[model samples]
Target chain A: MSTGGHKGATAAGRLSVLVGALSVPAFVGLWELIARSRIVNAVLFPPPSTVAVAVLDWIQSGQFFGDLSASLFRVTVGFLIGTAGGIMLGVLTGRFRLVSSLLSPLFHILRPIPPIAFVPIVILWFGLSETGKLFLVVWGVFFTVWLATHIGVQKVDRGLVRAALMLGTPRRQMLSEIILLGALPYIVVGLRTAVSISFYTLVAAELAGAFAGIVYRIEIAQQNMQTGQVMGGLAALGLLSFVADRSFAAIAERAVWWR
Target chain B: MVAMMHNPLRPTPPLRLVDAPPEPSSTAPEAIIRVENLSIVFDVPRGEVIAVDRVSLAVMPGEFVSLVGPSGCGKSTLLNAMAGLERPFEGEVIVAGKPMLAPRPDIGMVFQQPHLFPWKSVRRNIAHGPRALGKSKTEALRIADDLIEMIGLTKFASAYPHTLSGGMQQRVAIARALANQPRELLMDEPFGALDAQTRAVMQDNLLELRDRINATIVFVTHDIDEAILLSDRVLIMSAGPGRILRDLSVGLPRPRSSAILTDPAYLALKRDCLDLIRTEGRKAFEQMEAVT
Candidate 1:
C-alpha cells in the first residue's frame, strides 16, 4: 500500500513540474492572442512581440547600455556602503548597552520613514545629481540590514560567549570571531532582503529625476505614450530585480558555510 | 593480592583514605583556588534572591573536586564564579593568590553543552583558545592536533561541530578547554546532556584523560554517582541560598573505573550523600509550603 501511494505521489509531482514549465509561455500566448484579436487596443496594450521590438530598438539606439550601467552602479555602490555601515553600527549597538541606549531610539524613529519620502529633501540638498539617487537607495538598504544585524548580534548564544570568555578570548577576538560568526546567519538574511530593497529604492531614486536610468527611460516613454517601450522597461526592471534576489540567495547559502 | 583487586567478582577492598582530613579553614599556602565568604545575589521580579550565600572553599593544587547538589543549589553558580564569568555580590574568588575579576588564560571551563563554534571545525575550535592567547597559527594548530589526537577525535579533526555527534562534540569542547594548558579547569555538568550509555562512556574517557593531565579540576554536577566516580573530594550543597552542607573525602583507590560503582564502600558513601540531600530536599519543600 505504501509503494502504491509513493508511485501516485511521484506521478503527481511529475505532472506539476510539466505544468509549471508551461505556465509562463501559456500566459504569454494567451495575452498575445488577446492583444492581436482586438479585445484590447494594441497601441495601449502591446503584445510580447511589440514589447520585444521596442526592446530591440532600445538596444539599437545604444542608450540601453548607458541606462543599464547607471542603474546598476547606483544599486551596487549604495548597497555595499549601506550594508557595511549597518553591520558596523549593528555590532556596536548590539554588543554594548551604552551604545544601544544612545542610538537605538534615534534609529527606531528614523527607520520607519520610507526612502521615497526623502526625495523632496534629498533633491533640495543635492539637486538632480547622482548623489540624491544613491542616497535614496542607501537609505532604504541601511535600516533593514542594521535592524537584522542588531537583533542577530543580541541573539548570539550566551553559552558560546561564556565558553569563549573562559578560554581567555580577548575582547576584540570575542567580538570578531565568536559573536560575528554567531550573527552571520542573521546578517546574511538581512543582506538578501536588502538586495530587493535596493532595487525598489532605485525606482524611486530614478523617477525623482535622472539623466540616464531604466526608470528614467520608462518615465520618458510614458510621457511620449510609447506604451510598448514602457512595458519593455518594466519587464527589464522586473528581470533585473529577480536575478539580483536569486544570486543573493545563492551567495547567502554559502556565507554560513557550516550549515 | 594486588591482582585480586582487579578481579571484578571479588569482594571489594576497604576504602583507602588518600590523606588525613583537610583542616577546617584550609589556610595552607599550597591552595591554588580559593573562594572566601562569596555571595551571589540575583534581582528577580519578585525580590532579591541569593543564589549562593557565604560559600567559602579552597582547592589544593592538582586536586580533583566535584560540587554536587540538586538543581538550583547554585553549584554551577559557584563554578562560574571561579571561572570569573560571575561577579561576586560580596567577597572574592582568588586563583593562584590573585583575585579573579575577569577571565584569565590560566583558567579554562567546559559548559554542559558543547558550545562549539558552529562555523569552525573540531581542530579550529580547539585551536581557538591558543590563537586567542596570542599563539602563532602554526603553534596553535600543532596544539589543536595534539589535543584532537588525545581526545581520540583525530579522525574528526576537520569535521564541523554540527556534523559530529553530541558526545564527540563535547569531547572536542574538553580538548579545547585543555588546549590552553590552564592551571585550573572548571567544568559545569559537561556530560549532563548526554544519554546514559554515552555519559557512561564519557565518564570513563574522562577518568582515563585525568591521569594524563596535571591541571586542578573543579567539576559541577547534580549526579551523585558522577561526582563520586570522578573526584578526590565531593562538596555537597543545599538548595536555594546555596551553602556547602558537607565535605566528603572519596578515599577510593586510584586509577579507578566504573567497577567502583558496585564496591561496598562506595555504596556506603553514596547512601550518606543521598540521605543528606533527601533531608535537605524535604526541609526546602516544607519551607516553600509554609510560605505559600
Candidate 2:
C-alpha cells in the first residue's frame, strides 16, 4: 500500500509538470506560427516577447503600479458602500411583503440599465474625475449585490425559520440569526459578481474620461499605434482581474465553508 | 378535564391522591395555555385551504400534553397558533391567562427543524431570546449556560451549529428554547429529524428535563408510542381540517421507558390509537393520491 501510494503521488506530480511544460511550448509555438504565417500581423497582435518587454517597462517606471492602485482603491470603496446598502435593501425587501412591493419594482427597473449607459450622466453629475469613476463602480456593484440578496432571502429554508421561532428567538434575534445566516452564501456570491462588474465598470469609466488609469494608458498606446503596449496593458488588467477573483474565492471558501 | 391535580413535581407537603378532585382543569394552578375553538384558513393560489377546523384544547400550568395526528392533519397548525406564530382565522389562544395576539414573552416554541443560527456558537444561539428581550449580556450568558447544562449540551455550548451533528443541533435548539424560562413550551416534532437511536435518547433527555422544569408543555408528534410515553394525556387528531378525535389519559407509570412499549396494556393503548389514526391516515393518503 505504501509503495503504491508513493508511486501514485510521484506520477501525479510528474503529470502536472508535464502538462505545465506542454502548455508554455504550445502557446509560444502557436504565437510563432501566427507571426511567421502572417495570419495575423505581428504589428497588430504583437509577439509575446514585445508585449512582455512593454509591460516590464511600464512596471519599472511605476506608471502601471499607480494606475493599478487607483483602480483597486476605487473598486474597494465602491464595493463596500454598494454591498452594505444592497444587503440592507435586500433584507428589508425580502423579509417584509410591503417593503418588497414598494422597492422591488424600482430595483428591477434600475438594475438592467447598464453602468456604461450611466457613464455620460455620472460624468456630467460628478464631473470627469474620480467621483465619476466611483459612481459607475458602485452602481454596477449595487445591482449585482441587490439581486443576490433578493434571491438568497427567497431560498432560505422555511424549516429553519420555524425552528428558530420555536427556540424562543424574539423579533430582532430572529432576524439576525435566521434571515442573515441563511442569506450569507447568496450575499457572498453576489459580492463576487459585483466585484467582477466593479472592475469592468471601472475600466469603462476610466477609458471614457480619465487621463491617468490602466484603461487610459491602453487607449494612449492604441492611439500611438504601439500595439504591443496596448496588449501589455490589457494583459495586466486580465492578470489583476484573475488575482482579485481568486482572493475573493479564497476568502469565501473560508467564510462559507459549510456551503 | 380528567383529573384536578396539582403539579406533583413541586416541593409541596405530602398529600394523598384520593384527596384530590377528579376534574383536571380545576386545580391545575391556572391555565398556562388555553386554546378556544381555534380555526385556520390559508390563502393559496388555487383557493383558500382549510388547514385547521374548530379545535379546542388547553394545557395546564405544568402538565405535559402531546397532540398526535397523521401528517397534514393540522396538529402543527394548532401548535403554531398557540405559539402566536400563526394567526387563527377564528378562536383564541390564551397564554398565561392573556389572549395571545402575537408571540408572547412567556411562551417558547420548538419547530420541526433545529433552526439554529450557523453564524453563532451554541451558547450564543441559546442566548438569542434573552439578549433580544432585554437581558444584560452577563445575565443572558449565565442563563444560557444553565440551559446548556440542563439540555445536556454543556460540552458543545461553544461549538457552532455547522460543527455539530443534527441531534446536537437539535439539542442546542431545545436549550435555546429553555433559556427564556418561558412558562409554556410548544414543541412541534422537535426530534423528527433525528435518527432512531438519537431520537430515543432525545426523548429521555427531554422527559428528564421537563420533569425538572415543570413548564406547561404542548408537544405535537405523529408517533403514538412517543405520545403515550411522554404525555400526561395524548390528544389524537383526525385528518385534514383536523379536529381532536380523542383525549385519552396516558396512565403509563412515570419515568417511562422504551421497555414500557412491550407491555400488554401499552400495546392495547397503542392499538386503540393506531385504529383511529390508521383510518385518518388512509383518507389523507387517498386525498393526496387524488391530487397527484
Candidate 2 clashing pairs, residues 3+ apart or interchain? A166-B109, A166-B110, B3-B22, B3-B23, B3-B24, B4-B23, B4-B24
Q: Report model 2's TM-score to 2 decimal places.
A: 0.87
Give the Cα error of residue B97 in candidate 1, in Å.
1.0
Tens-place lDDT per residue, model 1, A1-259, is 1325587877888888899999999999999999999999999999999999999999999999999999999999999999998998999999999999999999999999988899999999999999999999989999999999999999999999988888888898888888888999999999998999999899999999999999999999999999999999999999999999989999888999998
TM-score of chain A of 1: 0.96
The local lDDT score (0 to 100) that residue A103 gets in candidate 2 is 90
Per-residue CA lDDT of model 2 for B174-227, tens digit only, reads 778878788888899989888999999988888888888878899999988889
For all predictions, the C-alpha RMSD in Å is 8.7, 6.5
Q: lDDT for model 1, on a 0 to 1 scale?
A: 0.91
**What is the CA-based DockQ of model 2?**
0.28
Task: DockQ for every model, please.
Answer: 0.65, 0.28
Kindly give the stretch of ten consecutive residues in candidate 2 chain A with the minimal lDDT sum: A1-10
